[model samples]
Target: SEMMIMANWLMARFLSERNLPAIFRSQPDPKERLYNEDQGTLFQNWMQRRLLSRFVLSSRSERHSGLGLNAYLTATSPIRKYFDLVTQRQIRSAFDLDTPYTDREIERSLHSLEQPMFSVSRLQYQRKRYWLLKYLEERIGKKEEALVLNRRRNGYQVLLTEYLTECMLPVSSGVSMRSEDMIQVTIQHVNARKDTLSVYMA
Candidate 1:
């Protein structure tokens, strides 16, 4: 199923490219900046990050206010993931007994499901983070262009050019910077044991 979804997305991209108008494909007689200072106001609503919540349901009725029951009822997962087996068992038990799990019971089950998954995710992040710090440590004292992504009272976050990896820039480095600024920076510190990389404006 995942392969099929990926194949379909690839096909869509190919088709979109093939169907693009010739004018869009050809070089402009005189290229112009795609966006200008005057248009900055048009993108004011763009946020760096935002969280979203959604509820899914299967059926709707007057009493339900048309919100409907969960449509994910028929969802299935392969045996590889433990949660799928647990879900299959719970669903079978519910149907066989003619009584679905209570809302609180379902909520508790879902909440508990996150623990192992989060552990796995954290482990993978730590592994990658270890390699990133090691790579940066070898390049200490080297300079590179970076974009500031965040600012705090003590330090800021900068994304390096080559790896696009983020590292901290301490205020004590005496290099003043603001978020979203592009500037040349040098690695000032790297603690591979702690998976930390620190930099200063070059």
Candidate 2:
């Protein structure tokens, strides 16, 4: 993972320095820090993940806060990702080994990809959630351990330790809970297609 990050970082710098047009991945700083190491290593990591910002792809290079880099792009995983292949081609073009793409061309390509990429991402997320919910259905009514991640207006956002899935657990008026609290919960209902999972304090 480290090597991949380094390679992508270097490739991004190389393309930017040469004024090449390529898809650069950029991410802003996280919203806020919710936990410190003193709280608990696991809890801190989870909170950090929760606070992370979403990454975006563009023709212009920009800082990637998640990777703590001034600029970054993904040139690896060509077979697994279309943007990687496009970035690799840009690098090859830099070395006079392939055709070069103009900034306008890259921008148009990104625009064309937006819908397809969003659709694929949404499908993958829904499919994974469906399977996970199906797995949980078998354990409905069973007690499971959960970690409170955040307190919402009407409920608490919790991580189901056994499955690593997050769900909202509504509490009655006057009920109180704190972040990072570990509590037992009973899975009351689950619907994979509807993407609903109901749980309550056990």
Candidate 3:
């Protein structure tokens, strides 16, 4: 949690310093989501839209994770992320290490890397969602307690308080809910192929 608090502050500082429209890639709280990690995939869809600068964030309690740090670069996931690969090349260049890819060469690759990286990320997301859906299918009819994270147009989105899961529940036309409200929800439906989960208020 302390790491996340520090990371979040660093992210805030970086954004404030540059005034850039930014992308924050955050995962679930390490205290919890570190186990299942789907919370990390919470905003897979939003991160891909046409955006300004890209940066990483981690460890937020809500769906969006934020671990604030002044600067972060990926040096892992060579197959799934080009930026990490580029970072690796940059590190090599810093050590006066000879390689086919130079700092300048990697610098020139960023423009082309964005779209492809996004595609790779989306594919991996779909794969994970598939497995999660399958897991949900097995647990159908079970009731779980969740925290109200946000109230949306149709209803509310809740994060499972005990399990590493989340889902949306539609409100009766005039009903309302507030953030942080504790609610009970039943795992009602799951479609693995479509990556859809249906939950009903209990």
Q: Pick the candidate with the highest TM-score.
A: 2
TM-score ranking, high to low = 2, 3, 1
Tens-place lDDT digits, model 3, residues 8-62 = 4454344335432222243433332222324434233222222223343331111
What's the number of clashes in each of the models? 7, 0, 9
TM-score of each: 0.50, 0.83, 0.57
* Model 3 steric clash pairs: 7-67, 7-68, 7-69, 8-67, 8-68, 58-66, 58-67, 60-65, 60-66
- Full-model lDDT for every candidate: 0.51, 0.90, 0.57
lDDT of 1 by residue, 177-202 (tens): 66667778888888878776778768
lDDT for position 55 in model 3: 41
Among all windows of 10 consecutive residues in model 1, the one with the lowest summed lDDT is 21-30
Error of 1 at 100 (Å): 12
* Candidate closer to the true structure by TM-score (higher is better), 2 or 3: 2
For 1-202, candidate 2 gives per-residue lDDT tens digits of 9999999999999999998989998999889876553574556777788789988988989899877898899888999999999999999999999999999999998999988989999999888889999998899999999999899988999999878889999999888888889999999999887889999999
Residue pairs that clash (backbone atoms under 3 angstroms), model 2: none
lDDT for 197 in candidate 1 is 75
